[model samples]
Target: MDLHFGDSEPTDEERAAVDALLGPPESAWEGADRSEEDLRWARGGRAARDRRELLLPGLHAINDRIGWISAGALGYLCRRLTVPPAEAYGVATFYAMFSVAPRPATVLHVCTDLACTAAGADALCAGIEARLGPGSGVGVERSPCLGLCERAPAALAIRAGDPVRTAVSAPATAQAAVLAASAPDSAPEEPPAQRAVPQAGDPSLILLRRVGVVDPASLDDYRAHGGYTALRRAFALGPAGVIREVSDSGLVGRGGAAFPTGRKWQATASQPDRPHHLVCNADESEPGTFKDRVIMEGDPYALVEAMTIAGYAIGAHRGLIYLRGEYPRALQRLEHAIAQARARGLLGDDVLGQGYAFDIEIRRGAGAYICGEETALFNSIEGYRGEPRSKPPFPVEKGLFGRPTVENNVETLVNVLPILTQGAEAYAAIGTEHSTGPKLFCVSGSVARPGVYEVPFGVTLGELLALAGVRPGLRAVLLGGAAGGFVRPDETDIPLTFEGTRRAGTTLGSGVVMAFDGTVPLPRLLLRIAEFFRDESCGQCVPCRVGTVRQQEALQRIVERTGAAAAADIALLREVGRALRDASICGLGQTAWNAVESAVDRLGAYE
Candidate 1:
């Protein structure tokens, strides 16, 4: 029996979408069955040649335009790009977003990750699903963090007519939440994509000053509010001087590793190679990390300007923003920002008439959280399965297509603008000596005001909790996202800096602070954390794959009150976590046990 019984054929609209990418598959394709030009166009023609390395982008084009990747579309794309069908399918299926089966025109992705779960995402999901019913034109799928921790119980709706997904910030009210997508596309008065937050003003805040104040869609508005001031500064200093300033600022990667930014740029710039690359790690998939999404949706030009400066300093002509598939609003805003920048002679060739050419291309990830890793991100961008590579030929010396590439996350890159404009010394003066500059912390869960907060590096957890409206009777806090550790109520006095958290035997991982009140069940939360690791593990290394599974099983046994004592299960979990940390290839495996280990040992969740 054909399981795909009544799947619909690709609509004319869908075909038109793919045609835009492959450039009107010659008339010969209809008669020759795509055989005559298969090799020539796939490997030789302009359509396939330059874009073959952009396999991930090609898939994104199809999915975004058509709502799903069909079997026929995949085959046609494989022939056009010269990628084997098996390889293409593997890449597509590996991601959570790329649906092989047909889907409704509008798909509602409900957040079910830790942050959302705490905010009653499970109830929200169940309510929406019950209302919609199965086989409805509107479909619902539980998603990992959609990067809207601040607006807990959020969802992203992918509509046919819209260019990007519609982000539903607060969807817990009623079944009206599902109405977000059920409405016909034509009934709209203005395109949702054109909608922008009205700009307001607050000069007191540094990183977030422009967030709510600027009309994110207006390039003119951005310019009026002192935008591009950093780029002009960069051109004056030249690439070398800009690198020196950033290095002096003592800024580090905000993706939790704290690697020096200026050192990375200097290494990439000093590389004796041509055609280097600058990759903006916009694949912000950490469960509670939504600062990048807010920045992109609110102040996108900052990232564009930052990428341009990065390219100039690294001596690269091309820049790629590897955006997460889940962040449709960020992707749409960035797409507009890049286009606007190019039209204004800011992004494309000979930028600022300085004789240095640089451009940025946005590539949407399929749905692999592991792709958040630098190496895995590179592999995904190159159209391969998202997997991490062993280190020692770090990204600075060798990255993204065997050329020296400097990859930084959204927060890390945006910080560059302030560092260069404010002067490294001034910027460095604000934060702790080792952890310089302002940081964006994602504060969510059980708080009155759950959102992204900007603060200097050394702010204490107690202070942050107060700002976020911590509920009384607090039991503990999940200091980081799933990959981070937990902190007991007594630990609120601990500073929130990377070093401070480490000294307290936990990590300020990915700037995620998920607050938990006494009402929440800690054991269940730990089990979910374990389950996330098990599901997200790429299974590349045996330790991570098997260890994550074992860890989850042990946690499950404890949660179910299995014959095994809580102490025995906790001990078994630690043993497995240690193995994963010691033997795993990438951070996915190495840090898989952080949340579970912390909850059991520090928070006494097992008891």
Candidate 2:
């Protein structure tokens, strides 16, 4: 049975809602040199040629600027670009990021790419939704691509604010100064409630804010407001002191396993090796999480500096950023930032004249979620299909072409520069015991304000839901992604700390929170998840490949025919869930049963 469903045609009300979200398509705020002809070309026309070339680019540009492209706006774009409205709609729908429906206050994008889905993106979406309420102020969106594919299942948070206007100028076009008679020197102020904390006020806060914390142009302002001070401080302290400070800070890995970073560094540093390596795991494939993308786009230097510090700490002379090929912009920015750092002598040999040599190179992955796993990532770096390798001699002992290596997620490395600069105890003071510092939770789906939120570990799910602005009468919560467990609405009261989630029979796998209201059918949701697993499974293991297929067929049977034997099917589902959990080879096959288990626990009667 085909599980892919077509979207319902937008209703009149939906069209109006979409229009309201996207302001007037033609604005005086646009560049003066831009002509009506340019607008016409951008809007698209009926001609096939005009529709493909003229209209699609314009729609993409509009979506990039507005965070969402509306149907009404598509009509306007068709007129401007000389393309048909239907063609524009087709292009918009082709990309998962564009939304025809009215946007909520914030957009929480969960990466549903293969890697993230396998990592537990589904559970994260479900958990956040259950806590917040479905389709609340936050609109949780699933993105097919965010370019951070190596960082599989990444997510991003875009909040609704005043439109950001930019001038479009061609290379040959003369610069025209068209000043409005009453144009304010400063941009119009956002309402007090909408304005988030200033991204530039504190250095540590700036790191958190850099995760889509603010605008790109504002990055120079961040640099001016003491962005690289931490790096400078690290240079002063030398590598050993930097390692000591990070160790004291108690910062652990933001990747699935919460291992202490400083200890990992110490291991590499103590190793008497010629070319020890530091690698930034930009393969954030865990679903319902996109915090790394924000950091990469908003503040590339923070990661650069953090990696530099790691290079110093581990006595490594070179570093490699295993960035996903999907994140083209991020790769570009990182490449630019690396050049800038090298020019400033912050990278390269004798950085800042301290005689400490370190440099970084970017290695792009060809869209694999399992590559997020260190061993698999290493294989990909060596030109192989991304797949996990058996552990014993972990990445630290034997990684990256058999060299002693330290691999860490972008967020974990981003925290390093700050912790090294600020004392360790200061960093440890933010979150609960064991899990120190603020965690960036990519909360999406059915919430009032779905976005990337930084909360100290140990905050209750209820509190996070409140922050997310979930609506009333939440039905269920799917913690983690497909790999996570499910909790009913009553469990929202549980604390969201790692320990707390563990106590509730769920691991805080990748910190993705998704909530859902009663509008979503639980059985249908499980079936969708089952189908995804069956399609994406690498088929290396019997439990994952066959089990997922079996589960999908069984669920289909139940959904198709409801009878007295439905209970028997549900029991069979429970048994399959347990088997997959126990017998699977890798995380993909292993945690594939999370959604099924959760579904059976909460809404088994529907099966």
Top model number, lDDT: 1
Off by over 4 Å in 2: 1-206, 210-220, 602-607
Candidate lDDT (C-alpha), each: 0.81, 0.64
Best by TM-score: 1
Per-residue error at 469 for model 2, in Å? Answer: 0.8
Tens digit per residue, CA lDDT, model 2, 1-607: 3212233333343334334433333432221135667655543223323223333335434554454666555655544444445645644553344565566545555555433444455665665456446545656555543533323335555443344232211000111101110121222222221222223234445356544344443446557745777877887887788888888888888876788888998887887655788889997756555677667866788888788878877878888888864564576678888888788777898887888888998876534556677877776565334556777777677787777899999989988766765668888898888788888776655665655667788898888878778777677777776567678888887887777888788778877776767766666667766776776565657887788888888888888777777777777877887788798767877887886776666645373
Question: Tens digit of lDDT per residue, candidate 1, span 199-219?
Answer: 124365678778877888999
lDDT of 1: 0.81
Position 376, candidate 1: lDDT: 97
